[model samples]
Target: MNASEANFDGIVGPTHNYGGLSEGNLASTRNEGQASSPRQAALEGFAKMKSLADRGLIQGVMPPQERPFLPQLRAMGFTGSDSEVLQSAAREAPRFLKLVSSSSHMWAANAAMVSPSADTADGRVHFTPANLLTTPHRGIEGPQTQRALSRIFADESRFAVHDTLPMQPMFADEGAANHVRLCEAHGDAGVELLVWGREGLGAYEGRFPARQTLESCEAIVRRHGLSARRTVLAQQARQAIEAGAFHNDVVCVGTRQALFYHEQAFEQTARVQDAVRDAADGLFDPVFVEVPASAVSLNDAITSYLFNSQLLEIPGEDRLVLLAPEETRENAATRAYCEALIASNGPIGAVEFADVRQSMRNGGGPACLRLRVVLTDAEHAAVLPSCLMSDELYARLCQWAETHYRDRLDPADLADPQLMTEAHTALDALTGILGLGGDFYAFQRV
Candidate 1:
């Protein structure tokens, strides 16, 4: 089962905006109520995917979920025609309306927990949509995400699409944001690392909620039918969480044989790495790059998202490349450490910066904007063609974004009937472009 991991980035939606909805995510809070460029956001996201595709890496795209969630408002007791619902909700519960319109799904890493065939019991790749019970806005993404994933990975023989976990606090899950997979090679058996934070209350009060629970991770492992021997569970440090590293990916990321992390990433960083090393024995030599808190503090790591950079094996080199945000290059401390890390000639050979500041301004970095799925050639080919990245597809997507997405959106804009219409019109065209059926989105069904 020799394979390659494809990076499936979520195309930023036409309603992309900063509502500062995420309580624990510092960037989101800092940029709260700010005007955003939906068009620029989508273009930047596509560029990142195209960059990877041009580099000859397997690259894919995840469609964004529909926004201006009217159904949610209806459930909350606002009822009437589509425009009426938006108007009433806007007039009565303006804040709630803004929360529903958030395009947080642009950060695709939270879309699902992926288990490659190499790690699953059935030898079939698995996709489980996240419940995202940690936040009010994100919690609504599950049902639609489930439908979208099942449509893309529909083949029964090669893919298994699991239902989202119940939206409960004890079983809260943040998808791939709290999960990582490391292997000697894409095709080899690997270790699935699940990171949990704050098992109980009075647990190092971080002024933010630790989204993923130990119970939630365990539930996913069982549902995915992963081998316990090949699994490593670690607790996220409260220090990192308080510093605004809400998800584990914000402080660490792993791919193939390399694990890039910050010193304060986990509660017992040494033991966590030791466990990973032991689990990977006979598989591949694990490469560990730890940025000591002395060189780059947790606050800097979260602020710049240096650790959130993608650690992809370069096209023709033995070393990895760090696909980071421009913020990392501009930040004094992170930039210095990044330069020194590459100069050290370690597993990381070079650092490439992408301008994804739109998403980054709302708490998502490069790694946060994509979901990693390891697929065999057959499995890869089985996915919908439009979901995969190609030159023709890239050009088409760019055109689509420009025509459908707005140039600017503010909190007040969430209530605009035209914004809702624009999102629906865009998603409608998108379904056809991606070969997703007419009924893929809620608006289409209407």
Candidate 2:
């Protein structure tokens, strides 16, 4: 999510985010010394990422042309020497296993965490199975994706699988593709593959209809058939007045679906709500989390910002971690949800309010950036039983970074071999202990 007080003039900005390539990025070439320009850095990173993909070290990629922001990214020194890029991608492999679903760029980039979003990292997987066709954007290209995939697969020791449905035009029928990817994801680890089907969700990009999303949900139900236990919740549902549901954006703990007015109206509020209910009914048992009347309105909250509250649907007794800035005024309802986790202490864990301001300045948040590499119940039981260890990877990498590179190199210079090797080693150790899954998640470009 782009902060309101962001330095738009810097390498990162709306222009880059919206797929616009600018002179600022590529204007400065590698003719300079050790420091690289944003475009140069991104290109270097992609070159390495590509190598990893070629070797099958990582699973996904992002065509450079489509990114448009590549030129600016190059300036940031985000890329690495070819070998180092492969190592970096290899180190991140294990973390992508836990992811089941994500937004087009959001999940692929792992936009919230400290790791590189354009490439794969913990909790973010980008590769889609052959069953799922990739969507084509304006400037993104094949080599970009190929290299990105290589970077994702760079580490031979770490492996993961991701099932992706093809990105068909909004007007095309993608139900079959959606069903196929979902099935693949479902069969593996707890991750569940998803499609941006429009069935009942409303129009997206003014293309795919709400009906398509609903239809996709329906397909999931019909194919897998809902589990015996499934609960539903509404975005505006309020158990109490001020405490229950806040008008601002909030996520439902049950369904793991984000609900709010999109850029365009979805027929009517009641209609959208009804569609949600119907979809729930068709797919799983309904336990609607009611949305209060006050919550009703037309506005678009940064969808990428709602990861912790919206996307996570952890099962009972399993802890859920949320890392956010404490100073930021969190929504009351969202706070309540976190409180619920704390109150349970029922093996359902929660880590609250970690300060990552500098990280956020780079663009991303806890969920936006972090990808969970879930070990099987068997795997978790074997290694560190306590989830706390799982949470320490980020900090551990930070410590390694501070001791080895931070004092000498800028955060943007992480792609350097000597510097990033420390990071890669730290990550390698973490993934080894954590044990990422196979065919459950992938790291690829969009």
Which candidate number would show the highest lDDT if scored against the true structure? 1
Give residue 100's error in model 2 in angstroms: 23
Q: List the residue pairs that clash in candidate 1.
A: none
Q: Can you give the lDDT of residue 154 in candidate 2?
A: 40
Per-residue accuracy of model 1 over 1-446 as CA lDDT, tens digit each: 77998899988988888898899898999999889999999999999999899989989888898888888999999988999999999999898898789899878899999999989999999888999988899999989888988888889899998888877777888999988898888898999999999663234445888888888888889988899988999999988888788999999988888888998899988899899888887788888888898999888889999978888876797688898999999999999998898899788888889999899999999999999899898998898878899999999999999999889988788889998998999999999899999999887787
Q: Count of backbone clashes for each model?
A: 0, 80
All models: lDDT?
0.89, 0.27
lDDT assessment of candidate 2: 0.27
> Residue 159 deviation, candidate 1, in Å?
0.8
The 10-residue segment with the lowest total lDDT in model 1: 198-207
